[model samples]
Target: MRRGLKISLVTLTGAALTLSASACGGKKAETGGGGDDKKTLKVGLAFDIGGRGDQSFNDSAAAGLDRVKKDLNIQTEEISAKPDEPDADKESRLRLLATKGYNPIIGVGFAYTNSINKVAKAFPNTKFLVVDADQCKVEGTNVLGACFSEEQGSFLVGAAAALKSKTGTIGFIGGVNVPLIHKFQAGYEAGAKAAKPGIKVLPAKYLTEPPNFDGFKNPALGTEAAKGQLDKNADVIYHAAGGAGIGVINTVGAAKKLAIGVDSDQYNLPAVAPVKEQILTSMVKRVDLSVFDFVESVSKGTFQAGTKKYDLSNDGVGYATSGGKVDDIKAKLDQFKADIVSGKIKVPTK
Candidate 1:
């Protein structure tokens, strides 16, 4: 249930900042220093287009940072921008953090690719962690990127969905149509196909580009999309649309059909609570794991600069157990999980 964040990349400008990775989840406490030291590992975040508290990607990443701040008693500064915000505004936020000496500023999605590239290059000495990065570089002082094997996770989710579906129809709703989101759709479709052979997996996106990830931030729109899918006779729907997915889940709530989640455990989020039992399950992408992993590395003085990818191979992403409603189908779901984890089965992307 780890490694679900996608890596977004950008320019060659390097900046100066420290990267602090947490060792565990949600607010670790502070420990006394051995020397006369007030070492503050200040970390900054550039949230995905949906911003924070969407019960998804941004939230998962924040969960990890929040853990580090609480448990390690380290100073933390967080800034969340709206999905509709301009690129320049996002860049300005990054710049402001840099000026304030936030080290190892992390950009949560590909949308911040250019902003991170420019920021990192401008402050060459600052280290950056771009989750779901695209081979981004800031010259010498930076380590690299980190990513997840979404395909593997998506496959497992698809398989599980298929195993539980009784209507032979399912749906996938994505925030945008980028390769990252597309991969989720592809894997889901493949899984459904695998389980039922002829199962119908409908794939849709809220945006085409530019505001791709923004699609997830609009609840009204998400609800409308889910309603449409349900009307098409799909009893189950999976959402990879940041905040938009919540909207989709809400629609499923009203319609009484089943829904699936992505990024984090929706069962833990208030927005999706009403439909908790109906949430079938989630395709968990452990953004929190990656964030805290980085923090732990930083705490141990083992922090490095560069890109790190987490996938099924590295337990970066996987499926959530049923919201407990699909007990009748757990056997198939468990088998799917085992096959994927043991490499005996592979979920296709293409």
Candidate 2:
């Protein structure tokens, strides 16, 4: 738990994580919160650069927690990522949540991997869940990792993009160029090629370096990238760029360009509510479902530990149901979805 991210944008480093076989192993204790009928569970969430309401991964996680609150009648606390200080604010949020007695704390995205790992050491008794990070060790079996096979979903989305594009040109934008992001890119490329042999995809990264994943927080960059793609006659654009994807949505709205949403249901999240008109469909990853599933496991005595991956085979990661446009490619899109679901098609994870 003493590990820290030396580099600005590097993901959670293994050196920063210290896990012992018996970290989360001990006697089973009874749960007592406020000792009341409500049984209040104060859950904490540390969002990524996109923060909450990004209409993407962060929003999805929040939505999951929201469901937990509704179903379990628990209270929730949240923290936003700061531009000035990264880990300190993240760590402070987690620590404060722990000190305030938020039993189950959840950190959204890989950005919190460092803070969560370090904080996990400080607060051994409190359970935590971290998405997009695998560097931390679970203490007393109280932590969970929420990951996704984004490539699998992106592959299906890519095929849909290729088949649906009347212009025969498509575009893709990623918030960061991490290994996970690369998986989306590789899948998009392969799927597009598979669908249309000579199709051309305009791929652009929000930034050339990893130092600014928060660049996903900047809508201006997303707008510019979308405009660039639209100008090139890309009828449909698929974006995996966190909050930056919101900018893409905005630009698509103004330009009347078709945009493919990512993570959560863009049509449902606040960030995309303003631009629902231009969103063709979204690439859905059940990050929210995974997060809730993790917490529910703790409640059910089946908490899983280690690097668990949620791939298409497990219904953990896949494309979102096409909005009103699912019928636009109805027969074909249905086949693709079923193919992946029924093993008729294997979406590559590379």
Candidate 3:
């Protein structure tokens, strides 16, 4: 819990964050009274690419915030990210929240690694949670690292694809080609191979790389990648792309093929309700659960530092069974889950 980011610190203010929030999504007014002894908790969130409504990662974090806001009577503020926003902007956003006296500010993705590290050092009292990024290495009683075993979840979905695929061929699409996304691809490929020995797993394609991270948002790139895989006779495809996953699902449905979704349950998403049946399953990374856990701890004054690893054993990451598309293979999938949890199956990280 004592890791640190080596970047220099920067100061941010409430006015700056208010303006940014307004420019991105209309800001929500803080509801609690401005008093030192107020019972209301002040919470802040800085969302990654695709923000709240991309029907994916950011939305999952928002779900946690929304639930706590209602259940705990807390005052909350949220901000979204612009494509290619520099690290300085992320630091400013975090600083804005902490400077305004919000406790336990959470950054929604790994992109906030550097900023969180630098900012956590400056504001030693406010809690900071970084989801999906372990490299931030922020160590202190106030910083929490909420990371997931994405590969473990992806492996489950990949097994489903293999079990259900009539074509013995499948594909994978990733948002970026970093170690993080590579973990997704490796686990997926391993799961498919484990389920169906010698199955033809197509080479994974990435939408973009760092400094050009639109791969997480642009559905067009997802569609193009999925189409290529489908053209190669891939009947089932799994994607670890964030918002871009919308296009992957659409293309799969149009071609009457099967798909595996990431982050939130795509089948349950209202935006993709019409094509829900097309999604056989989703690698449900429980960002909501993690966020809620942090919120509860802070509220109870039990805030702790260090990384909380969400793996198959903790039910932190798993494949969704909505739509009953994978019902026939449920028992088999359960066996895989058990084996993974028991450590008999060591899921590859990269």
Using TM-score as the measure, the top candidate is 3
lDDT of each: 0.70, 0.69, 0.81
lDDT tens digits, residues 268-342, model 1? Answer: 577777777778878899888887777556556566776677877577887777467656666776677677778
lDDT of 1 at 294: 72
Give the TM-score ranking, best first. 3, 1, 2
Candidate 1 lDDT: 0.70
**What global local distance difference test value does model 2 have?**
0.69
User: What are the models' TM-scores?
Assistant: 0.82, 0.80, 0.88
Worst 10 residues of 3 by lDDT: 1-10
> For residues 249-286, what per-residue lDDT tens digits would candidate 3 score against the true structure?
98988899998999888897765666788899999989
Better model by TM-score, 1 or 2?
1
Q: How many clashes does the backbone of model 3 have? A: 3
Better of 1 and 3 by TM-score: 3
Model 2: per-residue Cα lDDT over 1-350, one tens digit each: 11111222222221121111122444434331222222234566667665666656777787888887666555556666665466787887777777666666788777777787788778766777888774333333456676777777787778888887888888888876676677788778777787788888985555435676655666778888888889898888888887778888878777766788888667665556677877777878888887787656555445555546777778777666646765666566657667767877776655
Ranking by lDDT: 3, 1, 2
lDDT of 3 at 159: 90
lDDT top scorer: 3
